[model samples]
Target: MKILRKERGGHMLDSKLIRNNPESVKKGLKVRQGDSSLVDKFLAVDEEWRKVTIEVEELQAKRNKVSDEIAEMKKNKQDASRIITQMKEVSARIKELTDKQKESETAAQKIALEMPNLPHLSVPEGMDSRDNREVRTHGKKPSFKFQPKAHDELGRNLGILNFEQAAKISGARFVVYHGLGAQLERALINFMLDLHTKEHGYQEVMTPVLVNAKSMTGTGQLPKFEEDLFATRDDNFYLIPTAEVSVTNLHADEILEGEKLPVKYACYSPCFRREAGSYGKDVKGIIRQHQFNKVELVKFVQPDKSYDELEKLTKDAESVLQKLGLAYRVVELSTGDLGFSSAKTYDIEVWFPSENQYREISSCSNFESFQARRAGIRFRSNPKAKPEFIHTLNGSGLAVGRTFAAILENFQLEDGSVEIPKVLQPYLGGQKKLEA
Candidate 1:
C-alpha cells in the first residue's frame, strides 16, 4: 500500500503537482485571474525545505555512526570524550537545520493554502459575470397588469415582513417574517428538503450551524474569506455561511468505501454571512441578507463521475424553481468569475419581476479533488486499492429565503395579495394565498 501524506490545516493543490509542474499551475491560476507568483513562492520555500531536510538526514547519519564508534571505544576502556564533544556540535547543527526545515515547510504550505483552485479546462475564458455563458432558460416570466412590486414592498404592504423591526433588533440586512411570511419560509425549507430527499436520491442531514475553525478550513472557507464570515469573539467558532461548510466536513479526515462512490446529502440550515464589501448592493431586501435559510445539496463522488454529477446536482437545484413554476436560467460561470474552491460552476438565476432581470438563487459547483484533498476525504476501490481523493460538489438545492422572495414578487396580485404556488399549498394546509 502507498502511504498518503497529510498536511496540517489541509491543502488545495497537491504539493508534488505544484513542485513538478510549476508553469502549468501558474498558467491555471492566470486563467482564474489569480496571482501566479504564489506558485513561485511556494516552489522556492519548498526547495529550501527539501535542502534543509537532506542536510538534517545526512547529519543524523553521521551522528549515528560516530555514536557507535564512541560506544566501542568506551567498551575497550579507551577515551571517547573528544568524538563525543564533536557529536554535541553536530547535534546542535542538526537541530538548527531541522527547525529551518519546519519553518520553510510551513511557509510553503501557507502559500499553497492561499492559492485558489485552478479552473477546469471546460470553463469559459473571460472576466466577471458578463463573460458567463448562458446554457438554458426555463419557465415564462409572469405578466402583471399593474406595476409589479418588489418583494420587500409587497411583504411590507401585506404586513408579513418587518425590516424596520428586524433592523432595530439585529441591524440592517435582516428581516422579521411575520405570520404567513414565517410560515412561507418554513414551508419552503420543508418543501425543498422533501423534494431532494424523496425524488432526488439525497439523504437528508441536519448538521451543526456552528462549526470549529478546523471545519471551516477543511471546506476552504478559512485563511482567505474569513472576513466574510461571522465568528465568535474568540474566533474559535464561526456561524456557518451555508450548510455546505458543516455538511461537507462530515467526512473530513476519513476514507470511505468506493462502492458508495457518490454519497449525496441534502441539508437545511440557517446561513449567516457578514456580506463584506457589498454594503451598497442588494441592500433593499432579503435578497442579500446577513442571515438567511438554505437547503444545501452536497455530494462525494468518484473523479470520473464528478462532471456528470455536477450536471445532476444543478438540475436538482433547478427542479425547485421548476416545481414552483418560477422563471430561471442556467449560466456557466466564467473562469475569472469562478469561486475560490470551484473548478467549474453553473449559477441558477431566477427572474425577479421588480428588478426586471435575473438574480442568482443558487450556484452549483464541482470542486474536483480540490476540496477533497483539503478535507482529507478519500475513497478506495477495494481493500487492496490505494485511496484517492474523491471529488466534491455542492449547490443550494434552493436558497429558501430567495425562493420565498421570488414567490412574493412573482405571485403578487394587483390587490396586494400573494398567491401560493400550487406545489407549496399543501405544506401550508391547503392555503392558496396570503392576504393582509
Candidate 2:
C-alpha cells in the first residue's frame, strides 16, 4: 500500500499541476499578486528529482537481476565474486542517486509551500487591500455629539486598562485588563460562544492553545509564515497563531461519511503572533497586540457548496457586530489581498467612531480543499465512492480585543463611562454600564 502521499503537509499546492503545467500556475500566482518565479524554480528542481527517481529504479532493477544470477550461480556451485562486486557497485550508485533526489525534493517542497492558493474566478483583480471592493455596509456609523476619544484613551480614563503596566510586564503591544476590562472580555467570549452554538448550528470547541508544525501547515500558516508565529522555548510546537490552526486540524487524516458533509465548529482560543512584518504600523494602543482572544468559526463541507457556505459564514461573523449595536461593512478581498489558503475572502470591518473609519475585526474565507488536501481530510460520498478532499473554511467570529476596543470608543457616555450592549447584559449579570 502506498501509505504516505507527499501531499500531506509537504506543501499545499498541487505538485502535478506545478510540474506539468507550470505556466498556468504562474499566471494564477501573478493574478494573486504573488511572485510566480517560484514555479519556474520548482519545475526545474522537480524535473531533476524525477530523473533521479528513474535512475534509482534502473539501478534497483539491475541489482535485482544480479541477485537472481548470484543465487542461481550458488545453486550451480559456480563463481559468484564478480557478480557480488557488480551488485555492490549498483547499490552504491543507488545510494548516491537517492541522496541527490532528497536534495532536489527539499528544494521543490520549499517553493511549493511558499506558493499561495489560487484566486477563485469571481475574485476581482487588485494589487492589495487598497483595491478591495466593498460589498455592503451594515448599521449606521455613529455620529458623536461631542468629541470622542479613541479606545485606548477611553479605556485609560475609565481606569479599566493599564498599558504602561502591560508594557512593563510583557513589552509593547500588550495591555493589562483591569476590573471591568477583564469582565468585559470574559462577557464577550461567553456571548459569542452562545450565539454561535445556539443560533448558528455550530458545535462549540475549546481547542489547544499550542500546536505542532504540521497543524500550522494544515491551516496554511507554516514554512512560509513561520516568522510570524511564536514558539515554545523547549519544544517545536508554536503558540496557536489563531484558533483556526487548532480547529481546522481537528479532523486531519480522517475520512468521514457523506452524512457528515457539513461539519461546523465554533472554537475559542488565545491567539499569539510575533507580528513580524508590521514594524511601525498600528503600534499604538490595543489595535495591534502580541496576544489576543478570538472566537473562530471553522467548517468542512462538500466541495460544491463551499462558496454558499462562505457567504453564510461571513453573515455569522457579521451577526456579532449587529448584536453589539456596532456599525460595520463587509469587503470582498481581491486576488492580491487574499490569504494564503483562501480561494475567496470577505473582511468584516467594525466602525470605530474615534478613528472615523472602519477597522477589520473578522475575516471569513473559503479554502476550497486546499487545507483538506494538505491535512488529508476526506469524505466518502457513499460506500462505492472514493474519498475526496473536503473544502475547509474559517473566520474570526470576532477578535475579542478589537471588539473590546470598539465598544469603549463607540459606547462611550458623556460622563466618561461605557454602556454594555443589551445582548451581553445577561452574560454580565444585569450589569449595564462600566464606570470608575
Candidate 3:
C-alpha cells in the first residue's frame, strides 16, 4: 500500500479493457509515446493468466467439498482415507495454478507501471519541448545599454560566485555562493515561501531531503527513472530530487473527507539530482546542478476540478517572477513531452539576457489521478461513499538558483554592479546593489 499494489484506477491501467478490446489500449498507448503493439503482447500474457486463475478457483472449490465430506465421514466413524488422499491431489493442483497466476500478474503490473500517464484531450500532439505550444508571455524583456555579462561572469567579478572551489571539492555542476550571492538565494527562498503561504493559501512545510525508496515510488520516480536518483547503500534511501517527492507522499495511503477535497502545500528543500542524462548540457552554470534550493507547490483536489486547479497553480508560480519584474513565457507541453506521471503540463520559462532566450524556471502539471492511484491517496465524497483517487498537482514556484542567475544576467550594470529588484530590497536589508 505504501508503494503501489492491488492496482486500481489512476495508477493501474484498465487491464480488463485491454483484455476485452486490445484495440482500445493500442490506440491510447500511442498518445503516451508507447508502442502501439504493446497491447497485443500484454493481452497474450494476460489471457493465460485469466485461464490459470479460473483453474485455481475450480480446484479450490473441489478441495473444499472433499474436506466437508471427510469431516462428515469422520463424525459417522466411516473410513475417509481415500477422500484425504484425493484432497491432497486437489491441493497440489491449486498451488501450481496459483503460482502461474502470480507470475503472469507480476509481469503485467511491471509493464503497466512503465507506461506513462495518458495525455489530456486538450494537450497538443507533437514530440519534445520544440513542439510545445506557447500559451502566454508576461512582463518585458530588459534591454541592456551595454552587452550584458553572463550570470557566471557577473557573479565572479563581484566576488560572490565561485565554481573553481566548488569543483575542487564536489566536482562539476556544483557552485559556491559567497556574501551577496548566498544572501540572494536565501532571500528568494523566503520570499517565495511567504508569498505562497500567505497570499496563495498554501500551508508551508519543510520536508526531509532524503526519503525511503517507497516514498520515491509513490511519486512515480522509481523503477523507471532510478538512474537519475542518488541512493544510499545503508537503507535504500534516496536523496530527493525535488520537494515534490516528499510533500506529495505526505498523504500516501490516506483517505480525506469530501470537505477537504483540496489541500495545498508549499515546501522548501535542497534538491539533488545526478544529472545522469545531461552529459554536456548546462555544464558550466547553476542551471543543471548536483544540488540546488527550490520552493515547491503541491496540491490534492477532486478529479473534476483538477484542470482548473492547474491554471491557478501555474499563475501562482508565475507570481514570483512578476513580483521581481522578470520577463517570462508559458508553454503548454505536448503529449510526447509530458512527464511520466503528468497528463498535462505548463512550462514557465524566464528570459535570460545573456542567452537571449527564455529557459524553463518551473513546470506546473496536473496529474489527474495518476499519482494518487500510485500513492494510494483517496477521498470519500461522504461517509457512505466509496473512496476514489484524488487528483495531484505540483510545480516549482521558482527554482532559487535559476532565479539568482536570471537576476544577475538581467540586472547587470555597465559599472560592474547588479541592481536588486525593489521587491527583494527589503529581504536583503534594503540593499541597493551588489558592487565589485
**Higher-lDDT candidate of 1 and 2:** 1
Query: In model 3, which runs have C-alpha deviations exceeding 4 angstroms?
Result: 1-12, 62-81
Please state the error at residue 249 of candidate 2 in Å: 1.9
Candidates sorted by TM-score, best first = 1, 3, 2
> In each prediction, how many residue pairs overlap at the backbone (N, C-alpha, C within less than 3 A)?
0, 0, 0
Taken over the whole model, the C-alpha lDDT of each candidate is: 0.92, 0.89, 0.87
- Tens digits of lDDT, candidate 3, 1-436: 2112364332345566667867766766687677766677677777787788788888888888888889999999999998898788888888877778888777766676776677888999887777899999999999878988889999999999999999999999999999989999999999999999999999999988889977887788976899999988877699999999999999998998878768999998999999898999998678899999999999999989999999999999999999999999999998888998888999999999998999999999998887887778899988889998889999999899999999998888898899999989999999999998
Residue lDDT tens for model 2, 1-436: 0221464245677788787788888998999989899999888888888898789888888888889989999999999998798788889988898788778877777788888899998999999999899999999777778998888988898898899999899999899999878989999999999999999999999988889998888888887888999999898889997999898899998998888779999998889989998989998779899999999999999999999999999999999999999999999999989999899999999998888899999999999978887788889988679998889999999899999999988999887788999998898889999887
Residue pairs whose backbone atoms clash in candidate 3: none
TM-score on alpha carbons, each prediction: 0.94, 0.93, 0.93
Candidate 2, clashing residue pairs? none
Compare candidates 1 and 3 on TM-score and give the better one: 1
Please identify model 2 stretches exceeding 4 Å from their true place. Answer: 1-4, 7-9, 61-85
Best by TM-score: 1
